[model samples]
Target chain A: MTHLKTKHRLLADKAMLWIVCLFATLTAVPLFAILGEVLLRGYDQLSWSFFTETTPTAYKAMKAIEAGEPIPGGIANGIIGTMIMLGMAAIVAVPTGILCGAFLAENPKNRFSQTVSYLTDLLQGTPSVIIGIVTYMWVVVPMKGYSAIAGSVALFVMMLPLIIRSTEETLKILPASLKEAGLALGGNRARVMLKVQLPAAFGGIFTGVLLAISRVIGETAPLMFTALGCSFIRFSIDKPISAVPLLIWEFFNDPNLQELIWGASLFLLLFVLTLNLTAKYLAKKWNQ
Target chain B: MESVKPILEFNKTCVSYTKQTMAVKYVSAAIDRNTITAIMGPSGCGKSTLLRAANLMHELYPNIRVDGEILLNGENILSMEPVDVRRRIGMVFQRPAPFPTMSITDNVLAGYALNGIRLSKAEREETVERCLKSVALWDEVKDVLNKKGTFLSGGQQQRLCIARALAMKPDVLLMDEPTSALDPIATAHIEKLMQELQKEVTILIVTHNMGQAMRISSKSMFMYLGELVEYGDTATMFSTPKDERTKAYLTGRMG
Candidate 1:
């Protein structure tokens, strides 16, 4: 009887394993499907000029379509704008996030830190659309026009919670003995944090920063309200800008420019995928 | 002539994790300078707690209270700044922890770096060499000074931790079962290292291994249930413990 029961149980376990594998494959299918569709549709549009030139006007795109030629001009303006805004956001957010994370991790029981930690969670859960409107009111309105600075302020708000949470969590998981040993050496809290804890947590914090940038890179609603839209390549941050997602949205709106949509989407998707993969790889290498 | 004052003195030191329960209760003892003293006990016997109190490790936790005076060189350490007191004292934990981010040489010089005390290149080299030599690790790790200390073998890593502590040239070294996590050979290596280290710095070590206490320590303390049960010369305590609890523990009849 026992032998029979063991055989039945093993069969059940095998069935469960197969079911889980099927579900896992089902979950992965859409990711590959999206990659395949985007690659096929966008590969022809990619070229040297496609990356170098700014977006073509709707009239130019219509003229190109009538001539039976590929749309002339690329997403240089959007790419440059995204880079500038990301740089600005990371510059302000990284240090502030790390310090706040240190405070939260070091004082887990303090009432103020607990409140701040809770607020960070709430901020992370907030909708991107709401954040965009808030940025418009606080930044675009104040500056008297939509600007790259306003766009970055929205990205900064979005990135802050992620960096803080990662830094805090990484520091928290480290063996308490590490901190004790540092302190036992007579190192003050600040020096120990700077020299020991932060260095130890660098992998996780850096991964979080990369993940944060990837997270905000595809944001269109926030950029819509803050950066508005610019047709030409612009360098000055106080004026309007165009990001990759914004270009995709713009392409979606114009019938003649619709062929460029997949290219922008593919570029954004590939960039985010690479960032996520690099973050994972660096995290693994650093841990060892 | 009057006898020299003890290097470290615990005057009725008490450590309580809470307001109601005391982990260490009125444990009074004095340690002679440049001698090895072993604190032996079973698990949860407050031996480790007593050792941690000497270094003010209790300060990190908010609720855990350490009362009574811990004096170093006849000055009360409980009131002194934790950083100031810790500078004069060093510690090694059970598991070997050579800063993961640091190289072997940098691990040795971590105390200086953490204190923001810059050393000339020559002085840094000398201190690393001297400290590693004292821990018997200079020969093994000299070539891989740039490699991260985490790459070393367990015993070698433990020795590196010891070297890191020795680099500070502290007055007292508190070790909380530094060899407990090692294999027999590694444990023996640390035991032998401690014997040599005592000549330069006063050593207070917590161990559950009775043979280890008998092997290296000149003085022995046996604690039971948060109280110091016995304190005397090692030979005397091993041969004839005055307290019943101490004898029971040594004879393996009680924990």
Candidate 2:
């Protein structure tokens, strides 16, 4: 009886192992398929003109694409526009987010911190489209036109919660002994935060920044309401701009421009993928 | 001995994290200058709490109130700014706490930087050498001064912490079972270092090792459950404990 029971257990365990492996492969298939398709199909369009030229808004470009001719233009304008908006948003968000995080970490017991933490949590749960619409009303309406600056405000709003939460968590997770050591050495509160806690949490904080950037980099809903996607190249913050995701959204329906959309999708995916991987790697190396 | 001034004095000090439960009860003791005083007790007996009260290090927690007087050089430290008070009386905790983010040389100079005192590169180097040598860690770490402080062994890291505290030029040093996490050999190394350190600054050490207290301290104080049970010269306390409770404790009847 014991030998027969043991045999039955072994069979069950083997069945469970194989079932898990099958599910694992199932979960991985779509990710690999998407990557494979993008890399193979997108490689041909990543040429010099593909990068340095602007998109043609004309419907005839779709005819050229349908005729199996090379698309006439590239997404340099989208790439540059994305850079401008992200850079602007980073300039405003990085310092503000870190400082806010520090305040939360340092004065954990204060009533104001409690209120701020609750507000930050609420803001994080709020939808991305709502933020984009709010930014459009606040900045675009005031300026009487769509602009990259308004678009960046939307991105900044989306990024705040991630940055603040990550920075706070990074600081909170450090050993109390580190801060106590600084205090014992006669460091003031600010000095302890800057020289000890901040440095100790550097890797976590930088990783958080990268994660925040990645989260917002490919968001098209916010940009649609603010920057509103222009065809021409424009660097001015006050002018409407193009971005990879926005371009993909606008041209995905056009048969002639479908290739550009695929190419842009690939760029967007790889860009965010590289950032997330780098952030994860740095978090491991530094937090060690 | 009578002519020597007390470097630190606790006048009926009381410390508590919350209003309801006290960590350190009404306890008073005087620690003389240029001498090593050991506070020995069982776990959670308030020895560490009493030692931390001297420098207002207890302020690290919010809502914990400290009432009564803590005097340093005849001035009440309780009334002074906590930061400035800490600068005058440094502390070393049970475990080696060399800043993980700093290098050996930088760790030693951290005190000066914490105080916002800018020293020239030459002066900073000189101070680092002097402090590390004082703790006898200079030769072992001189070649790797730029390496991270965490790269050192447990004993070396603890010694580096001592050097870091000493660099601040504090008038008194408080150690709370600093060798509890160390091996016997490392503990002996620190005990010997404390003997030399006492010649320059008043030392107050909290330890659970009764032999360690008897070995290095000229004066010893025994505390139990938020109160001081006995205080006297180490030899008299160990050889002829007057209090019945002290005798019972020494004999390991109860903690």
Candidate 3:
């Protein structure tokens, strides 16, 4: 009887494990579906022209649709614009964000630090569109125009909280002895933080920077209000620019150019995937 | 008879946490140069706090108040820059902590690197070799200078930490349970190194092991419940302690 009872319990455990496995499979099913659809629908859109040509105006795209011809345009400028905007964001945010993070980590118990920490979290929770609106009032109103710089300002606000929180968390998780050891060696607080503490937490900091970039790279709501979309190759930082996500958003609803949306979507997905993988690889490599 | 000035001195030194009573009560003591002084006590007896006060290592945390004077080389060390004090009086913790990101040679030179002091390639090489040799790790690590410090065994890592401290050429070295984490053989090696190191640098060690104190220390301090109970020459103090608490701690009768 005891042996039979044991067997029954093992059966229950096995059944529960299968249920968990089923849930896991369910979680992955949608991801595979999305990947499959993008690959199948978007592969036909890929060409030298698709990558290098500028986007056509919405009016021109509509005319092409009415004539039963495919839209003759690409996301080349959108890609470039996205790169430039995100590049400016990184440059503006990384140093300031990392410094804020160091301050939070160094003084975890101070009242002023606590206030700053709460404010950072509040900023993170604020919507990207809200950031766009704020940037518009601040930069667009002052400069009296939509500019790539304004788009970057919106994204820079987004990047700060991510970098700061990750850096603070990474530094916090380090053993207290590491800092003590450095201090005991007669190194000043500034030197210890820069040379010892920062290098030790580089893996996590790198992950944070990548995460911040990926998070803001795909943002379209903010870009719509600030960058306001460009139809041509935008070379000046003072002018408006279009990004891949915005291009996809504008073109996907048009029946003739749905494939272009998928193509841009695939490009953005690939870019994000590359960033995440690079982040993981670097974190693991530095950890070793 | 001429009296030699003690290398380090504590005058009515008291320490307390933010919410608690004193961790190290008003304690006064002196440590002579060219000798190993051992501090012995039971757990939570404030021995570690007293040891940390030597180089102001206790200042790392917030809301811990310290009152009174800690003098090094006849000057009040509390008045000096904290880094300068720490640089002059190097410290080793209870557990070995070699910076994981640094190579063995880099770990040895970390003090110099972190202090923004540049050394020539030959000087750096010579310093690393000399410090490692002093800690008896030169033969073991001579071939692996580029490898991470954590790649070594626990004992070897501890020695590497000591070498890192020694590379700074500090006037005094304070160790808190330096060998408590190692095996008996490793412990013996550390004891030997401390004995050899004292000829040039003053040494102060905190230990829980009574036998170790008996073996290596020329002077001993006994602490209990945040108070310095007794301090004197090791040989005389073991046989005839002035305080009852010290006698009880030394005897098998009580901790």
Candidate 4:
């Protein structure tokens, strides 16, 4: 009878292990596949000139081939435009998001704070496309054209809710005892929040901001409507901006543009991957 | 006892957490300056609440309402700014709660930093050394001042908290079961430290251990439920408690 029970337990354990393996593979395979495909297909087109030159005009490409020289179109302009827009979005979103998060976490019962939290929750659930449409109506239409500034506004809206929610959750996990310790040491509420509570939750808040930046950097749909597309290199916020994601989207539809699409897609993928890896490294270091 | 003025005087002070529930009711006592007064009670008694009320630390709880007066150095502490009251009255909790993110030196100087009062680097170092030495921790932690405060053993952490409290130079020190989290040897060390510290600052300690109260306290107040059952010199209170509840509590017959 004991031998039979042991056999039954062994079968159960083996079944559980297989089930776990199946679930792990199901979750991991698609991510690995996408990464593998991008690295394999994208590396072939990447070059110094591809990163440093502008998009090749139809006439310019034919002329370059006639001269038997490499094409001059690089992603330098797109990279600059993307960096500028993301920087502007971060400047607008980070402080506002963190302050709102702190207020919501610290004074959840305040009537105005509760209303703000409710609205933020609603906004967080709103689709990114809807945010793009709203930004087009409010910012792009008002300016009488699509511009980098409008793209930044749309991206800021998308980033704010994510940052606020993550920051609030991190702050909420901090113990009441830590706050009390600060207060008991002759510190007022503001002092306690700034010096003790915020510092304690800084690592989590930073990771949230980094994650939000990564989420927005690859966004194409919103920028398509808000910033439109421009081949010219322009750095002004009021001008039409060309970012890697929008460039990749435009190039992917043209059979003749397929090679450039892979290169731009690789740039976007590497940018986001670097951000995620940096955030993970920082979170681990700060946790210690 | 010397006839110097009391450092803290509780005049018919009553503390209630909710409108319907009272934690401490109409307790009156005078704590002499530079002396140790221990409050002894069972688990549910109001010893800790009373100590918290004396420092105005109870004000942090929204629903807690305190009536009557807590006079500190002739000023009504209840009427003072909680920050200022806390500056003059430092509290050490049951557990050793040094800010886990900070080093031992930083934890000791937290009071100054949190208050936005900047001191010279030399002065801050002097304060940390003096406070650590006062708590008999300097010799042990002198080489590792930059180590995390939470890295210390349970007993050492409690002493670090004491040093942190002392760095603020508060006039009155309130300890809520400060040594309860420590082992017997650590508790003995703390008790001896308390005796030495009582010559410089007034101390009000809430303890569940009757033996500890009898050992270290000059004055002992016994409580039952929410009321003060007996208040006298420790020797007199232990030998001849005026109330039956006090006698019952000390005899281990009733809580």
Residue B254, model 4: lDDT of 87
Instruction: Please write out the lDDT profile of model 4 over residues A1-288, one tens digit for every residue.
Output: 999999999999999999999999899998888888888888877898787887877567667667876555877778888888999999989999998899899886779988988899898888888888999999999899999999999999999998999889888988777887788889998888888888889998999999999999988888988988778688888988988888888777654455677778878888899999999998898777
Arrange candidates by TM-score, descending: 1, 2, 3, 4
User: Fraction of the real A/B interface contacts present in each candidate?
Assistant: 0.93, 0.80, 0.80, 0.66
State the displacement of the C-alpha of residue B9, model 4, in Å, after optimal TM-score superposition.
Answer: 2.6
Off by over 4 Å in 3: A1-19, A57-72, A253-255, B1-3, B239-244, B251-255
Candidate 1 accuracy as lDDT: 0.93
Comparison by DockQ, 3 against 4, better one: 3
lDDT of 2: 0.90
lDDT of 1 at A9: 100
> Model 2 Cα displacement at B180 (Å)?
1.6
Q: Write the per-residue lDDT of candidate 3 for residues A48-101, one digit (tens) a residue.
A: 888899987777777888888777889999999998899999997998998999
Task: Write candidate 3's Cα lDDT for B85-140 as tens digits.
Answer: 98889999989999988999999999998899999999999999999999999999
Identify the runs in model 4 with alpha carbons over 4 angstroms from their true place.
Answer: A1-14, A58-72, B1-3, B101-103, B143-148, B253-255
Q: After superposition, how far is residue B218 of candidate 3 from its true place, in Å?
A: 1.2
CAPRI-style class, candidate 2: high
Q: Write the per-residue lDDT of candidate 2 for residues B1-255, one digit (tens) a residue.
A: 643878889889999988899988888988889999999877898888888888777788878789989898889999999898889899998899998888999899998887899999999889999999999999998999999999999999999999999999999999989999999999999999999999888999998888898899999998888889899999999999988878887878868
The CAPRI category of model 4 is medium
**Candidate 2, residue A136: lDDT:** 87
